[model samples]
Target chain A: MKEKLYRAGDIFSRSVGLILFFILWEAAPRLGWVRSTYLAPPSRVFGALWLLALRGELARHALISLRRVMLGLLVSVAVGVVLGLFIGYFRRIDRILDLLFQAFRQMSAFALFPVFILLFGLGELSKTIIIFWASLWPVLLNTSSGVKNVDPVLIRSAKSMGASKAFIFINIIIPAAAPEIFTGIRLGGSYCVMAVVAAEMIGASSGLGYLVLYSEETFNVPEMYGGIVGLAILGIGLNWILHRAEKYFTSWKEV
Target chain B: MAKIQARGVNREFQIRNTLGRKERLKVLEGFDLDINEGEFLSLLGPSGCGKSTFLSILAGLDKYDGGDILVDGRQLQERSFSRGIVFQSYALLPWRTVIKNLEVGLEIRHIPKHERRRTARQYLELVGLAAFENQYPHQLSGGMKQRIAIARVLAYQPDLLLMDEPFAALDAQTRENLQIELLRIWETDKKTIVFVTHSIDEAILMSDRVAFMSARPGHIKEIIEIDLPRPRTEDIRNSAEFAKIRKNLWGMLQDEVLKVQSYGGYL
Candidate 1:
């Protein structure tokens, strides 16, 4: 019974926190902390979200963003997993490519927006490539380290049992390195979202990022607030999906 | 005839110190030994005395700087599967169930799938792990995982078994129990075995002969024969013969242990 009360109290506290945040934000404009004409209140933002949904604009924009994210993330995981395996397995490859990758990784994702815009034009092609490039490094680097650092004792045991090199890599190194590789994928997925949003905000005919930029430029303050809120929800939802995936894949890990 | 023999073997590693000075570190020098068919020989030494280094060379996992090691009078070669080694760590594949882990060697040899499963099951039963065959390594105890490691080795059916302190990572009670099980397996297989270990009591319990070794630039200091009868029990460990053998090995090893400790990572 005490355990049940503890769980109930925890849930109530979290709900209270959420309600208090909304109340403060709503009260700020009513109390004239800032011009209501410029920032808009929570009530006004909800109204704008409802209107947009009624017209189907929100769904169209969300679908565009979601499709772009799916394509970019799929290509990145495949390429990243393959490239990481190669770099981890062979020292010669790692030596030649590591410095170049490190240099490119240090360059900011937003900094590449202008370059990608020119290379592929301000189209879906440009946005997709930007997202792919932004997400690649974290996944590749982490996966490489994970595979390279597998226990040598495990490798020795495998070899002594008459395992060939290919068998050891598949049955030993790949599984041992899986947890770290999953971590890389999670990080890469989030970066892909951030890059796609930045690309859409800069220039795009459609997407959730464009919705926010377009509303703000035209002085639709409530719509702008609603779009930002939608983006936060989207980010949180994607992160939740990735967290579940990592948990599922690494179920064999001790901790 | 002896199943495995080493003659005038040497091993050296080129290493860089903290100050970036390159040095040729000799791990084993002029090491010679032989283990008769169906005999258990423990290469006992202090840490850094090259027992593990010697075992790696014998397993064909690492090459020596000089001289030759032979199994049934054949030279060590790359891709040779004549020797099976068990490592100090459990080293069981985390993703695989016990049965699959045991099947790894047969897969490498491209054995038929049905045959691989059949062979793995046989060995799993041998290690008393048939009930836990579907569980992953993480789900098992340390001793259970080591038993899976043994099952994997036995599945390969190599004629010479090389173990590098295989029970070192386990708790004391588990180590004692596994030592008995290992002797039982040795009795059944009648394979030549070369075991490396640092524990004097363990060496006394399991080996037919114990080769005491010296520290860095390692070489055999003495090889003391154990004349204990078969079907050894915990009772044998408290016997006068065990005490005498332990004392002799300890005396030979005392100076080497101090030398290694004094250097404290210098070597």
Candidate 2:
């Protein structure tokens, strides 16, 4: 009972700042401290959100953005993990590709957007490729380092037991490097959200990013804030799902 | 015939110096010994004396530049399921539960799942940790982890066991307890074991013979026969014979220890 009360108190304390900020936001417009047209109040923002939901427009755009992020993330994970494993396992491969990969990593994904547009055109494919490009580096680099840093003692122990090379690779190396791989995946996940939103803002007809940009252009400040809120929710939800997945897979790790 | 015969074993390491020049560092030279079948031998020496290196070679986890290691009258080629090794760090798969860790070797050998589970449980019981079969290695104490390590190797039923300072990291009391437990286990199975350690007391209490090793490049300084009676206990540590053996072994090791210390400790 005491612990439960303590937890309740903890939650209450943590949310106090958010509650105060919202109250201040609501009071500012009412008190005319700021023009309601220039900065929509929290009430107006939430009201705009409810209107968009009722029209089903919010869901439509959110689903499109969600789909793009998922596609890009999936493709990046597949290619990155496979390539990273090869690079990490073979010193020769690493030596051959290190300089090229390092150069590519140094270039900004946004700076290459025009090149992608020129090559693939301003379509779903280009947006996805942008997200994939942004996210792939983290997964690839982290996985390679993770595989490279696997405890030699573990490998030696497995070898001493007469474990075949394939068996060692599948059982010892993969599981041992999983924590790091998950870290890479989590970082890649956030990068996916960032890159997808930016890509949509730059060139796309639908998505939370496009909605935010379109609303702002039409002077619908309240709906723009609503789209911003929606994007925040999407980012948080994606991160939470990835966090849960990481916790599930790496449950063996000591707190 | 001896179970393992190391005839003039030699090993060297090439390391880059400050000037980026390759320099050969000899770790073992003319290291020779004969380990009789089912005999418990302790390779005892100071740190960096290459006793562990020799044991690694014996386990076929390492290669020697010049040597013939005969196992069962055949030249040792590579690692086989016939020899299992336990390490100082307990090297348990952190992701695997205790029982699953025990089953790793069995899995590698392609044993059936049911048989692997049974053997794992049996070894878990033998180590007196039946209740901890479901617990991960990180959850266990150092002593418990080492016990699990021992059980993991024993689960495979290897013909030979190679232990490199398996109990060195535990507290003194825990070390003594494990030493007694290990002896008890050895008494029942009598598997040929090459135990590596730097402790004089551990060497005398656990082995049929203590192979004293010199500093790098290491070779057998002397092979002292430990004629202590079987089924030894912690009380054996307090015995007069144990003290005599300890003193004698320490006297032999004193020069090597000082020699290493003079050279600015471990190389």
Candidate 3:
């Protein structure tokens, strides 16, 4: 019971700063310390969110952004994990492609926006490709390193049992590398959300990013803040889901 | 006929020196020994003596640049289910539960699930870890983990057991307990075992013969037979005969240890 109370106190203490920030935000505009026109108070922003929800605009934009992120993340995971396994397991393949991958990984997805738009014509495909490009490197690199670093003793132990190569790869190497691979996937997930928003901001007519940009351009500051709030919620929700998945998959690991 | 025979086995490692020049470091040279079926043998040596390397080669987990290791009249080229190895580190799969870890070898052999479970449970009982069947490796103590390693190997029913310092990482009490337990298990089946360790007392206590090794390009310098009666007990460590063998073995091992220390060969 004391432990429970202590945990409650801990959470309250942690939230103190956030509560103070919200109060100040609400107070600053009403007190005229900041212009209400430029900076919407928390109350006004939340009112704008309710209005957007009532009109179904919030859900529409969020769904579009979510779809793009999911699609891009899925594709990146497929390509990254499959290629990473091959590269990690085969020294020859790693030797041939590692330098090129390292070079490409250094280049940002946004910097390649012009090239993507030029080829894919600024549609859903380009937006998705941007997210995929942004997210691929973390998954690829982490997975390869994870696979490469699987304990040699484990492999030797398996081999001593007359385990075939396929059995060892599937049973030993993949499971051994799973924790690092999950880390990559989580990092890739955040990248997907960030890239999709940026991509939408750059060229799309829809999505939370476009909503925020379009509202700002129209001087709908409250709605813009609402869009920012919506994006934050989306990002947090995606992260929570990935966190739960990571926990489920790596439950065997010591906490 | 010998269960396993090694003839002039040679292994070399190409490692870079401090100056970044590649140099051939000889790990084992002209390593020859014959392990009789159902006999217990210990390869006792100092660190960097390549006894573990020779064990790995015998397990077929590593290759030798020269010479032959014949098992049952066939040349050992790769790992076979007939030869099981227990590593010092107790290389149990952390992702697997105790029961599942024991099932690994059987799984490789494509044994049926029911049979695998039965065999795994049987071995787990033998190692006195049946209660930990659901526990993962990381949750177990070092001694418990080694017991599980031995049980895992035994679950597969290998004809030859190759152990590389299996109890080296445990505490003295745990080590002694396991040594007694291992002998008990060995006595039941009498599987041909080639154990490796650097500890003189452990060597004298456990094996029928101790293959005392020399360091820096490791090879068996002498094979001393342990004539102490079985079933051996913990009190044997203090017995006059045990001390006599231990003293004789340590006298031979001291020179190799000094040679290695002087050469800075602890790799």
Chain B TM (all candidates): 0.95, 0.96, 0.97
lDDT of 1 by residue, B1-267 (tens): 667778889999999977799988989899888778878899988788788988887776788989878778777765667678888787777877789988887877788999999999999898898999888888899999888888888897887788888999999999889999988888886787888999999998998888888887888878889899987887899899889988888887887878887888544
Compare candidates 1 and 3 on TM-score and give the better one: 3
State each model's CA lDDT, in order. Answer: 0.85, 0.92, 0.92
Docking class of 2: high
Q: lDDT tens string, model 2, B60-82?
A: 88889997789999999685889
Report the C-alpha lDDT of model 1 over A1-255, residue by residue, as the tens digit.
999999999999889978999999899999999899887889999999999999999989888887888788888889998999889899899999999999988988789888988888888888888889888898898889998899888888777666788888888888888888888888988898888789789778788899999998999999999888877777778889989988888777777
Superior candidate under TM-score, 2 versus 3? 3
Candidate 3's residue-wise lDDT over B33-73, tens digit each? 98899999999888888999999888888889998888898
State the iRMSD of every prediction, in order shown.
1.7, 0.7, 0.7
Full candidate order by DockQ, most accurate first:
2, 3, 1
Q: Show the colliding residue pairs in model 2.
A: none
Residue B42 miss distance in model 3 (angstroms): 0.2
Candidate 1 iRMS, in Å? 1.7
The most accurate candidate by DockQ is 2
Model 3 alpha-carbon miss at residue B217, Å: 1.9
Q: Name the fnat for model 1.
A: 0.69
Badly placed stretches (over 4 Å) of model 3 are A1-7, B261-267
Q: How should the candidates be ordered by TM-score, best one leading?
A: 3, 2, 1
Q: Report the poorest 10 consecutive residues by lDDT, candidate 1 chain A.
A: A156-165
What value does the lDDT take at residue A1 in candidate 3? 100
Candidate 3 residue lDDT tens string, A22-50: 99999999999999999999999999999
